[model samples]
Target: MFMFKNLKSDLPASIVVFFVALPLCLGIALASGAPLFSGLIAGIIGGIIVGGLSGSRVGVSGPAAGLAAIVLTAIGSLGGYENFLVAVVLGGIIQLVFGFLKAGIIGYYFPSSVIKGMLTGIGIIIILKQIPHFFGYDAEPEGADSFIEASGENTFSAIFNIFDNIAVGPTVVGLISLGILLLWSNVLVKKGKFFEVIQGPLVAVAVGIIFYVVTQTNDALAISPAHLVSVPVPDSFDSFLGQFSFPNFSAITNPAIWVTAFTIALVASLETLLCVEATDKLDPEKSVTPTNRELLAQGTGNIISGLIGGLPITQVIVRSSANIQSNAKTKMSAILHGFLLLISVILIPTLLNKIPLSVLAAILLIVGYKLAKPALFAKMYKLGWKQSIPFFVTVAGIVFTDLLVGIGLGLAVGIVVILLKSYQNSHFLHIEDNSNGKHKIKMSLAEEVTFFNKGAILKELDSLPRDTYLEFDVTKTRYLDYDIIEILEDFAFKAKERNIDIKLISKRGIVENPDSFIEFFKLRPKSKISLS
Candidate 1:
């Protein structure tokens, strides 16, 4: 009853997401060089099956733009689309294994900075990628996120190219659609439930269809078929069913198939886990998704999709964010959108095909703006270098490269920042009394000092002046690496020659004039050289 209770809100949001997803399914399938119908199958399976099985409340799964490159390459390298389906099924099984292994924890290892960077980067990329489509230059396939497009033109060059090739019809439709969305979101939707339930995107799409029909005979303003949502329209029900391609089990023994399978599994799992974390952050209720369960759900979705001829699937942030922005209260919104995709193909493919791609581009333009707002940059910078460095790098990386590479670059910077913090936090210095012409320095070790702290500890010990009195404190330390312990042990021996009296204080108690620290710490075996 509770799930159904949000049906009112969920139904409206589902309509928004369905419009957002339609062109993406066809474009990604086109980009992947697979049968256009396969993308729809994947979207249907992703929404219904994955939505049903997943633990995430708002995250949506479907054919991912990020995996388009891999799918394209695999389809060719594996010899054919049918053989590639074998990889998709195997990839899903691998994800299922990952779920059982509880490997979903790897998702949490990413720093908050990198995740934010990913969202922002994707946002900027969406804006950049859609500008050309908004102007009606549809050479670049929908959902193509890479800087270097499959069409030989890069993101920037593509934008410039749009000036020469822009179609007046789609551009006008795109502008009108964008204006309507802005008004609906900024004004009309707040006026009444009527506007809210009808949804801004749905209205924009409806107007776009009317615009297409009215200008059909006017060559200058008439929208070309190339600028529209090109959902494959089969002549008969049997022909539509015949579009679904099964995997070739005979290729199961092929090494290339296995390699492609593993690659897809690893990449898909990472993308899904990252999206899960992101969508959870975006969730208004702040609900933590059971990531392992998500992996299992994705695995199942991929298996079903592949068996019936679909590209690989992952939890896509674009659709998920759109769902959240649309105020979806539960996964029901996602499930319902899947049904819409299914039904639209079966019953209303003609009407659905008439909706301009530019209209959808306008919708995504808004989605992208929400993710990459200017204020987020200022906020990240205020957190200091530890956060800002990764955040900037991630944004730049995603803008110039692709999603995974950008995340990887940002993660690398985050790790370096962490290591630097660890080095500085190895120990604390306290200046006690400086009487008797011998400086007394009390060095308190940190909670957990690893080999990363070795150089800092060694430097401090080496800097001690002659006849200094050293108080080495390890009482608060829970774990000490052997490298740091050795530095201490060696320093304990050398202090005697330098007339630096050493007092070793640990959990066991104080050892005045102690010659060896290993005996007190008991962490490392006595070095044969130290004992000798």
Candidate 2:
């Protein structure tokens, strides 16, 4: 398989992605109000299972922060986490059904401007959300992505709180780690393959650990346990095995359970498809991921995860971006990262827990900067308002609200832009001739006209001057809406009252003063119009 072909690049990239996914898995679990271990379980399954099955070359899958609110509320409404597991299982089955239905084509509908906006927005959120952790403030939960945090402090407020809460130790370590990353990426990598293969994130984590160890005795400089990674340590093999949760199969009969399952399937599928689109765009090779296959892979992963008491999984942009930025060559990087997480938890939980969170924050900061650079903003703006409006709106919405809300806002704006453009292009109106004091005006219908063009067509028809010659051209038209045909028929009668002579022309036939527009054109049943 191609899995091992690029080990030099993929292995190092996997290490970097592992570091990123570890904390996020736990943080998203915390945000979801589930046992922290559940997130890790999802991460492991997502990487090993979904990564292997997925057609995406660069995407990374895991417990998603976007689903935290849904999981938290669902747990409560469903009466318990066990009941929620049943929904999770059912959701996976529904996703499998969706895959069979080939529902993944929905990803193509998203505008490029909105997709770019999503990447930039997530990047900004990473930078904004990590600032507090970089400064050593740990009040907010790790995986929380919303602007109004669970700690009752908004994103900006948390940054302002840094003025009072900033600690000496974590900040120092964070700065050093950030410097190492920058030096490695900017200078050292240019020298040799040794620097390239070693990876900066791994070195940064090592330094952070050393800093923690060396400062343990110095009260003023020691990194506190609260500001470090926290992986659950099991007492023994049996205890570790006990951590796995099973679904309450009897709850399958509950109507509420079905609703939750459908909701999860729909949301998770949409998120995965959107991430697939975004990930493909970010790929330097411009490789396209098979969207339908991705849904099947995700479905299989969630089913397995739920069987073992894990949270729902989706393709996460943060870890995927990190994987790409780290120069991963294939899906091997994603699969290996999952194995790393599993090994770390089982063999070296204590060592894993010792790594400082601030170091991880520093790494994420670089990832964020690359996505939302100043030059990108200028580039999008130069493309003009049409492209920039959705881009900026999406960025602002994600910063001010949340991921889905921001995308929704951008998508709404994108749709409006399409409608306005469509309205303008419905038809072309021009004066063909003006002789004998009567303007010979020709109104050519566009290639396709729907009810959306009704208003413009009606207005132009009613405004025609008396005693004018009107040439209604459909020679170039292919599909015409029944609504427009009705409007034409009505206008034909109105033209007579205004003393307007009419000439109707089309590829089908030509008629002078045609009695019926629909009869003359013989509009096809379903092919000619869309309902309206």
Candidate 3:
């Protein structure tokens, strides 16, 4: 029902996303140390099944790079890839339980500043990671998001290493691919319907494949097979069917399998929620996705993906952003892209392999540029320190560490900012000179006075001059902390020594000579007492 609404936009957008997601699915599987086809299985299920069930119009689901390390370790710990499949199946079941339990509300609590930082940080990571690939340095797998790579080099070091080992053929293909993508986005799409119908990345891949074929005899111009898309090709229909691995259901009794399952469910759900939030922010239409439904959809997808020998899946930001930038208008684009991956891998694996990795890298570079534009930094900076600090910290943390750790650091900073503001706004103080020559000092409590305000309130009370008329205003206060009340009671005795005449204005009206602070407060109901 959510599909087929915008064929004109969705069709071409699907084609672009398909190309973008194809390599990522394979690359993430390669990174996870799983059979490569498992990634494709997750991609197909993510797009066709999850996309259909998801409430997100623009979100595209697939095997995630974020879970690569988890999967790799789980496979080894579980004794085999098949045992890991058992965990994936259990993980999906756990995710479904989480959806029913309404745990998706956690998605709503992430600070927007941190989410934006995440987008910008991932964009920067994309650009950094792809640079090596752009120059034909293919040591790291495609779609790897972490700073530290499986190849022992970090993101920056990988880029530096590229200088020493650049492949001319892939470089040429990459530059041409980048040029075509830019032209299509900036110029060709505006020129006519013909250009608009043909997506730039599609054309880039076609040309890259042609270039690779034409340059096979020329050593300098020939792009090696290692630098090309490498889908697992089946020799026959039986072999293609054999590629689909079933989970070892007997391993379901293993306790370690349950542990791995729960971990996958938790991590995958969090990633999906975060991606859903990020994608919704990026949507031009400002659509709100149903976070709970998204979890349910993902749960269903992971179950199917695991049962069929696929890696775990989550809503991936990279493909979703690509779909949005390509003008995708509905879930149809995501579904269609999944179908494209399925058809291409099954029908034309050899032809698909001909497309150079550099071309795909170029396409991702464009996506990365759009996400982490220089203008975004200026805009965030203009929002002032409260917003900008967390934003910058999130970006820096993600660049230096990893996504979850970066978000945690940013969230901690954001919480501190909130506490600081609360501390500053706990109460208001005012002083006025009466005609009789006595200074009248009024201290009005904030709507909710907490223990954090006790020090500030005490300092203000201590600074009151002798022989002053002091009024404690609590008329508008809602909930008063016991600590603050105790402070006020302790100050009463001190006020007498300073010759200060204290008036307590509360819900019960003004009391001229109150008994002991504790007795006065205890005798009157909390509602009847207003300090004004």
lDDT of each: 0.90, 0.90, 0.89
Q: State in Å the error of residue 232, model 3.
A: 0.4
Ranking by lDDT: 2, 1, 3
- Per residue, candidate 1 scores C-alpha lDDT tens digits across 1-532 of 7779999889988899898888889888888899999999999999999999999898888999889889988888899999999999999999999999999999999999999999999999989989999999988885535563667777888899988999999999999999999999999988998987888998999999999999999998899899999988889989998999999999999999999999999999999999998898888999999999999999999999999998899999999999999999999999999999999999999998898889999999999999999999999999999999999999999998899999999999999999999999999988778859899999998888888988888888899889898888878887776777688778878888899988878767889887666666554463222210
TM-score top scorer: 1
TM-score of each: 0.97, 0.96, 0.94
Instruction: Give the Å error, residue 475, model 2.
Output: 1.9
TM-score of structure candidate 3: 0.94
Task: Please write out the lDDT profile of model 2 over residues 2-70, one tens digit for every residue.
Answer: 679899999999999999999989988887889999999999999999999999999999998888888
The local lDDT score (0 to 100) that residue 291 gets in candidate 3 is 91
